[model samples]
Target: MTSKTGAHLRLLGVSLLALSIPMLSGVAHAEDASPGASTSDEASAQAKSGIAEGSDILVTATRANELAPVTASLQATQPQSIISRSFIEDSLPATADFNQIALISPSVSNYGAANGVGLSESKAQIRGFQDGEYNVTYDGVPFGDTNDPTHHSNTFFPSNTVETLIVDRGPGNASQLGQATFGGNINMFSRATREDASAEIKGSYGSYNTWLLRGVLQSGAIRQLGGAEVVLSAQHIGSDGARTYSPFKSNNVFGKIMIPIGPDAKLTILGTYNENSFNQPDKDGATLSQIAQYGKYFSLNNDPNSQTYWGYNHTHKTTDFEIVKFEANLSPFATFDNRAYTYSYDNETLSGSDVTLYATASAADIAKANMVTLTPGGAKTVGVPGYTKTNKYRVYGDIAKTRVDFGFGAITAGAWLEWSDTYRQQRDVDLLTGNPNYVEKAVKDPVTGIATPANIKFDQNSNTNHTEVFAELELRPIAGLKITPGFKHVNFNRRIDADYNQTTRYPQKLSNTYTVNLPFATVNYEVNPALSVYGQFARGFLAPPLSYLYVADPSFSTIKPERSTNYQAGAVYHGHNLSIDADVYKIDFSNKFAQDLTAPASQGVVYYNQGAVQYKGIEGQVTYAFTQAIAVFANASRNYAKTRNPGEARTQVANAPEYTAAGGILYKQGPIRFSLIDKYIGRQWFAEGEPDAYKSNGYNTAILSARYEIGPVRIGLEVNNLFNAKPVTNISPGKTTLFDQYYYQTGRAFTGDVTLTF
Candidate 1:
């Protein structure tokens, strides 16, 4: 049988197995005792005490009973997982990148490139979906690049400031807003303001000469400031990464202020600033032969005189954010929330390609041949020494929501409005002097009196406007049944104006608008206080990305939105000693945008709507508390994502691993805590149509962490990739040559941290 046929058979078998899960409900029921309270009053009381994890932690009876089931949120009708603050601090990898912290959950994959956390490149994917296909938000506010839906991992908020990370394994309710909400969503909440005054300082040193220092100060509730509380934090990190020539550094500052307005109202303002720089990293993976020659973790040239020298390939980025939010309980049964926010991103980069151009000629001879001035580096490069790129953008938005409850049900309504203005350009410059050869037409620096060129490379000014309004109704007709239905209307507008290549072939100035309505319905049935079954049906939409709308063609307007029908069913159980959750999901996607490389080379690559695709998966997590101080947890996911386009040989998706598993043992005794973990990723196809030589090998990694506390002092140590495994983490899918295909991860590394609280 053919490989494609074998894959299809396996997928069918998995689906059949998943559909048979409901029959096992009797087995779970046999293990439980009599049920407990099932009233809203009980739930309200439980919420006040926070969620509990059974025997995972020893607590007083009041504390244990008071804690609610963490998985049973009113708005989360599908599967959801939460990584708590304690877990993040005590069990995660040393780097503590949000992307890494999320790996313990099911149906997620990440490529944390060879750089320090928050100082280089990284991406996270959900199910078989890529980076831009998922929604990520901080403090319930969504932010991303205006030109594209993806986010910059190194620019915005860092992991230290986060309190909780919640990954919702489905497109959430009507309140969630983003271009890629069709896939799933990630919700990050910042650390809460402290009621008591305290200060914390931490220092750490790890492998690859990595160093980190951070400090935080909390100004307890201030009576003079109307019971206000404030928090201030500063952090610095520097590292020589696992890869050759990849050095990184970053610095950040954050502040938050909270003021109590009245018995039922509060106002908060938060701000953050981050600046970082790192050597330019290649996206294409190095091949086996290249690794044999340069050793693993190889990067570009390191010779100072070469144009591709480590120092010559670098990027500098800065981000600034500020937000003000207000919350008020309008009445006993109603509440209102509103947020206003603004943020900006600035990036500048210098990089080079074409290694032979510099290696084959002398500086003076090459300069004479090209008629350009001789530059400082070794041989004059046949290519430009510095092809610089700059991107700067500013965003402003406001979101408001209101919730009201009647005797039998609740109503939620929300609206969002956002505006983005951006400036992007690329040009050649002198690498050594950092002087650009071209500037905006009719523009010049008054002091320098340098003439600006009217014709250069590419430059554009773009603006985007987004508006959304949504409403959801929650009805609780019976004591153990709840139903939620919601609808959202979205309108997006894009405007682009400027110059392209300055050639006669292309012109600039274009605008497009899209409007769509999405609907969602979910039902949750509580068989008992500790067990619940849920199902949902959602309609999702994704407009053509900015590239297809503006950058591809100046006047093309036929591109349409991508639509999907998503279905999910799951069961959750939270008991005195066991917490288990499972879910089965399937999505039918139409008008899926797939890259078309068959067009003439002169026209360049573009996107085409490939007819339809189907993605199905089964993911689940189980955690059992052995005792008050010990627990074990495991999670696994299996996915089958294939395109249904006619006559397509490669049905599989690229960069998507079919299976992933994570599990570990956790121990907490008195003032000390420790964990040993393992993570595995299955083999993946690099391209849709490819032979065995182009495929990627699977990899396994192990992590260990331990922490101890005494009074106001805490010490922690972490060992990542404990087996010292050198494995490829990424590969270029469609590249014909094997020379650029494999990117390896860092070997075993150690980090220790000491923190003092006062």
Candidate 2:
């Protein structure tokens, strides 16, 4: 995808979103509220202001401490967890990513990256489900690659942009819309605009030459704009990395504006843009011989002119996002909420690979020969440098929901519509001349105004349209018992208008549409104000990835959608000084997707449909305050995953840990604060049939942190991986042994940050 095409797509997406706003507003006005209303920052503010002064609302404040974690978990119909802003600040580095934040929750594991905070190198698993098997959303809007419904963490929202993280361990109610709702959902809420005018400056420096600087400015409500408030934030980060040749740099700009539409309504708009470039580090684990020769952080090549040179292998990515939201109180018993969003991602990854013509010799041997002397006739025969991929896409979506109170309980109804258009291609280039080598001819791109290689390895244009309508009712038949039932109708349409490969010189077009009806039910018994128990059953489905259509094989279109049935039971206890939450869940998933990672990158992705997989897990979390100045928190989860395919060599899913656990102690006295956090991850498998060599030993990591505050300035320091444990988090399988390919978790690192507020 070229820059000119990206620009045109962005403009078109913006125009479409802008034109749809009035239509959405008209729809919102026609309906009132229902049950389980979607909460917005505006709604939260309204609730705070509506509290009667000196009333019972103030009395409940005395019990707020007792709720703790239970306060958030007990409210959900299925297993769930919440991480607060304060906990995030206390437990993680300022630059941590969502994968890191997710580790605080049970049943979640984040394989740390080579460069700290480089999301591209990170992968997360929840309850034995891989990254693309679950749903992740931003403020209720789902964001991901149109081809796979999987996210590229490096191209989206960063940790600093979020204020809260909510992890639901089961398929949510009918209101939730996503392709991978079966494994569950992670919802990230953006930081709210401050109600008071203020400015904050933050800077951090960490081990491995990592540094970050950020600034935020907020303007309080302005009388001229009907009590409007705005916030602007900018940040820059760079790191030399914990692993050799793994360097990262990024810049982000974000803004938000909020306006009170009327006494009972509000409008908010947000926009963010990010640009990043980073060196691609070696992921293949070092062999025993290589480890002996170069240590753990070993990459394949070092020659300056080699394709695998640290200087030659890199990727560039850019993202732009914007959203408009409106919320209004239609009546004392009704509310309406709606949101529209537009976003685009453009990424180009350049990588080096073995020059096929000279593949007879090992890459190392070729490097050695070329380094010693070059052929007299021409430039040395170095490895090929090429764009591994160029993926550019624009997404637009809108959701409108209404909640209303009923005499028995409440009812909620909503609809969601989304569309995406993508342009993707890949081609090889000359290593010495920095021009395309495999191009059989040259042709001018109509949009880019540049001569493009006619011999594209892969080229395609894809478009996807998704629509859903959901309705749910909350029924309270007794004082302590509540039952909810919901249903959602979902439809997906994917069209691959053009798919081309230089080998065939033919364009193939494919289109597919899938429709399904999902039903969900939950039963909750309060038992008492301090205790609650809930059980839920739900069904969900995932459409086949759009990229499958681009495969050269026409049979690829026959792939079926993945589907799942989920069941969950949970209990929560909220006491005066303690809170506990526990849950057990099971999912029966069919038509699972599997990939052949052993294949080379230039071959594109090879996917197969694994018959079925069953997953079951148990998770528990507890928090206790021994005194006003001291507290302890702990969480753990155990998971079991197995495939039903009898012919398959391995029954257990690969890359998922058997268990995960975390514990921490917190202390605060006056202006001083402290925390000691510990985490443990159980063994993770890399191959089927429980191959002993292709598994990680799993390791322990700890963090110590302290902070002090005086006036408007705050200072903090943290030491992560305090023990400097160099544990393998992933393994690459080899024909003879493990470590043929792999990456290790980052080792011990230190970071210190200071913040000034005015």
Return the top candidate by lDDT. Answer: 2
List where candidate 1 sits over 4 angstroms from the true fold.
1-75, 116-119, 281-290, 354-384, 430-455, 501-507, 550-557, 594-607, 733-735, 738-741
With candidate 1 superimposed using the best TM-score fit, by how many Å does residue 151's alpha carbon deviate from the native?
1.5
TM-score list, all predictions: 0.84, 0.85
lDDT tens digits by residue: candidate 1, 1-758: 11221121111011111111110000000111111111111112112111110001111112111121122221236777656566676776435677776777788777765554444667877887877887777776788898878887767877777766667777776766677777777666666566578899988898889889999998977878866778898888888877778788888899988776755566779899988888853242444654676777766667654555687788899999888977665766666668899999999877653232332245674453332224322333333355667889999999887767675777778788999998887765655666553323444323355533532456777899999898878777987676778898999898877555222213457688989899978787767655678888888877776676433443323466788888999887656677677989999878877666676555545567777778899998877777766777788899877777788754667767788888887887778888888888777776665457557667877889898999888899999888987776776643345334566667888899898999
Please give the lDDT score for candidate 1: 0.65
Tens-place lDDT per residue, model 2, 509-548, is 7678988899988887767666678888999789887756
Give each model's whole-structure lDDT.
0.65, 0.67
Error of 2 at 707 (Å): 0.5
Q: Which segments of model 2 are wrong by more than 4 Å?
A: 1-71, 281-290, 300-302, 354-364, 367-385, 439-455, 499-505, 552-557, 594-610, 647-650, 734-739
Worst window of 10 by summed lDDT in candidate 2: 52-61
Look at candidate 1 and give me any clashing residue pairs. 285-741, 285-742, 286-742, 363-380
